[model samples]
Target: MALTAYEQGLLAVQRREFAAAREQLESAGDDPRAVLLLGQLAGEGLGEPVDAAKKLSLYERAAELGSAEAAYNLGAAHANEQRYKVSLDWYRRGAELGQSGALRMIGVMYATGQGVEADDVEAERFLLAAAASGDHLASFDLGTLFAYQRQDPVMAAQWFLRAAKEGSAPAWRELELLVPRLRELPAGDTRARTMLGVILAFHLDERDAGAELLEVSVAEGDPEAQRSLAFLLHDNAGLPDDKARAMVLFRTAAEAGDGYGAYNLGVAASDPHEAVRWLRQAAEAGVPESYPQLADRLSELDVDEEALRWYVRGAEDGHKECMFAAACWYRDGFGGPVDLVQALRWYLSLLEVGSGDGIHEAHKIVSKMTDDQIHEAGRLAGQILAADVLVVSRRT
Candidate 1:
């Protein structure tokens, strides 16, 4: 028995014989599927010169012959050319034929106000309809809309999980970032709960799980992960003998110039000289907590000048406690001088961050300073807070 023209065309396409496929498809009379496939082959330049006009013609012919897929292709092509209104017409045709992709695009258009008014209600309706038919992109878009436009983290996590299970990588990544910010995980959703557990177990407080996740990074000589795993192991994650291995990891990380590793090694050092050396290196490497540790040690030894410098470093790095310490040092003349303006500046900065009871102390500084010095402190505080505000705005 011999195959029909349309069957022969499909077999040739599957066999990578584009020239043969096109010939057979062109002769597959009255078959809209054949015409649509021919248009796709032409658009993709499969054994033929790419022809946009020819592709559009064939798609229109196929759509006129009642092909829902051809209507979708027409809508997508017009969308690529930025003819939103025209694309909407074709998209509506596909939607009328119950095409999930067309429904998703119509929802997107509503969401973005492309060919119509930005209507969240309509967008949600269309998107939910598409999602009911198992469109993965519709699920992902729903997650994005909820997470960003609606400010609904719980709903966002639910949709992202659905898209991820449907194999959307972007949805998986978005879900991971959103999980930590969620105060409550979705109820009765094992997948969502599992994702939250995986994040907490792999990235946060579970020592054994953290070690498991960090194994490859540590083996590949990643100083940061190595240091982190070693720190957790040092806390004895149910293994007393792990302390010896933790020390070895700390040493390795320190040798690779990891600041936390140096800080940890310094904390465990018996000799004062070696401890001070490692602590200094940790401070110089810009470890935020190391500043307070090194500064407190210096202050205990009456090394006020060096202690003040370390405190200021931590304060400038946005550590709230260090900002308070720095302000106090300036106010009390512990490090250099009783510079009222500098003290007021640090106190105002601390107050802006809501970290210290700097208001009472600021009042003291205000009483001691001249009116001109008070103005200077206010301006300096504005400049400092402005930079922080810009950083926070970008993150949000």
Candidate 2:
């Protein structure tokens, strides 16, 4: 079948045969698609020297030929040139022709009052309309509007999360910006203070500021705040170094049924039996960190069988230390009978989770294993890594 000139031009562009693409597009005649492509090529200087006047002329011709994208391009060009009112009119034309990006620009213009009166209502309406039409950047703008103008962190967080779920990198920046404004929420809402403190300490690295926020929640008997503040105080990062106070806070939070606090208190306990008891509770409470910690402490107490069980669980959960320990135990027959294949497989598994330590250790013992065993281990590790990559890709 003979291809249309427009389609042939597209094929030429894909192959980087820019001159042929331009000729083919020109020969396509009155097709707005071809005209738009020609204007884009001119604007991008694809097949010739950069000519702003030529690009603008081509865009104007394309826009006259009913190309919504050309209208949008003209809007962007005018906006970049500081022709705000002209850009707004072009953007409105694009929006009238059903361009979500144009709608987003109109919302931004109204929000900033660049070429229109500042109207939060209009900004919210247009931004929401664009966002609901699958414009992810508009979701980010809506988040900023709520965060900066409305001063509503709760609403801002929702919009930012939506943008983030749609893969907007700026959405995370908006989340960070909202953290400061979260302080304005009512102090009676300990949940807000707890969240604010956690973000400040961990995400922003403002430990002292985070501690102050956490103190407010702690005074209101918030266990989560107690745990976070305790972790900061015990982190050994020059933040007052009050291990005793941290220990008390950990104990307080642990007794209130905080799994992370229990895990920390278990680590800090002097007696092995007490540590094991608290760690067991933490593990039962579904704390992933407790798995590796409990395994190590149990191994110290010479409880190899139970320790190996926790190490295997943690290894499956992608804990590097547990993977190392599990491999070593299987190789040395410390917890059970020697199984070089299991050790090799666990060692290879570490590479999937972004570590090379397991493979490094595997090299020493691969000589002791059969060729078939090594092959099987490599196959299993490859399958696990592929599955993990697929899951991560789906998330982004």
Residues 53-138 of candidate 2 have per-residue lDDT tens digits of: 88888888888888889889999999999899999999998888888999999999999998888999899998988987768799
lDDT of 1: 0.76
The lDDT per prediction is 0.76, 0.82
Per-candidate TM-score against the hidden true structure = 0.47, 0.52
* Residue 184 CA displacement from its true place in model 2, Å: 3.8
| Top candidate by lDDT | 2
On the 0 to 100 scale, the lDDT of residue 386 in model 2 is 28
Candidate 2, residue 102: how far the Cα is off, in Å? 30
After superposition, the stretches of candidate 2 with alpha carbons farther than 4 Å from their true spots are 1-172, 235-241, 359-369, 383-396
lDDT of 1 at 304: 90
